[model samples]
Target chain A: EPEVTQTPSHQVTQMGQEVILRCVPISNHLYFYWYRQILGQKVEFLVSFYNNEISEKSEIFDDQFSVERPDGSNFTLKIRSTKLEDSAMYFCASSEEVGRNQPQHFGDGTRLSIL
Target chain B: GESVGLHLPTLSVQEGDNSIINCAYSNSASDYFIWYKQESGKGPQFIIDIRSNMDKRQGQRVTVLLNKTVKHLSLQIAATQPGDSAVYFCAENRLTGNQFYFGTGTSLTVIP
Candidate 1:
């Protein structure tokens, strides 16, 4: 089964520094999403990308965050200034299409540690 | 029975026993629900899902039961094993969008 792939399984960065998380979604998937799970908390949606543009975003995704489909297969999330609270497990997901019933496949995740 | 806690609620079951994890969703407009399993330090793995139109859906070793009237969902694991020990979360999809609201997970511990 094809699955989403996330790079740099673990990322450590200083607070206020920029960080870009990379993901390679399934080849045929049309929708890509980014979600974060803070330690001991529920997984939270960050943003969803379709057609090279953001379709939806949660309040947790603020001005410091942005997502881009840099190429056909690669989706990236950029945080202009990382904060200590940003430390969490960031997951990348891909779905065949965008709809309420479409199931999203997830990658193992990238553990971001903001120090 | 459910209780609120700062920690993930833990359920312990012996191997080969059946396990049922319950979830209560907040949105009445959610039409689709999914159950995911997350191992420590890993992303959520899709388990099974059910649409509001259906009351039950079965997978390999798991079954999802949806009670739309009460906004409740449950995942049942048959013949549970050590490999099934993980955090289980239920997520609900809005009637019109792609955002999934995840429930606070329950930790399943299969004692060998």
Candidate 2:
């Protein structure tokens, strides 16, 4: 089956540096999302995108965080001035359409480590 | 903020026994629920989902039961196998928003 794919399975960056996590959602998917899971913690929603605009975001998605669909297939999350707390597993998910019945499919995830 | 939680943190079942994982949500407005399984180094994989209008839904060897009144959800696996051992999570979505809130996961270990 077609699935979401993420690049740079593991990322290590300095505390003050900028990091961009990339994802290629299913080709036919119209809605994309970003979520993070701290070690041994529940998954937290960061943002959702549709029609090249943000549909919704959580408080955890602050000024330092931004998402972009630079092209037809790529969805990226950029975090500027990363901190130690920013280290976590970032996952990209997508669904063919938005509805009560459509379930989001997730990628394996990119492990982000801040030094 | 709304939250979803599991009833137990861990469960163990025999190789051929049936396993049931339970979850509870604090949001009364949640209209959709999903169950996901995650291995040690992987992201959550969708297993099954149910709408508030339905009390039960089944797929393959898995069954999902939803109780709208009590805000409860459960996933049942028939004849659990070693591959079925993983961390299970429950997620809920409210009609007013597109975001899904995930719950604490339950770790299931299958003793073969």
DockQ each: 0.78, 0.70
Instruction: Quote fnat for model 2.
Output: 0.77
Provide the fnat value for model 1, as a fraction from 0 to 1. 0.74
Distance from true location, Cα of B44 in model 1, Å: 0.6
Segments of candidate 1 deviating more than 4 angstroms: B1-8
Ten-residue stretch with the least lDDT total in model 2 chain B: B1-10
Q: Report each candidate's C-alpha RMSD, comma-separated, in the order given.
A: 2.0, 3.2
Of candidate 1 chain B, the 10-residue stretch with the lowest lDDT total is: B1-10
**How do the residues A19-106 of candidate 1 rate in per-residue lDDT, one tens digit apiece?**
9999999999999999998888889999998888899998889999999887788999999999999999999999997666888889
TM-score of each: 0.95, 0.96
Between which residue pairs do clashes occur in model 2?
none
Each candidate's B-chain TM-score, in sequence, is 0.91, 0.93
Pairs of colliding residues, candidate 1: none
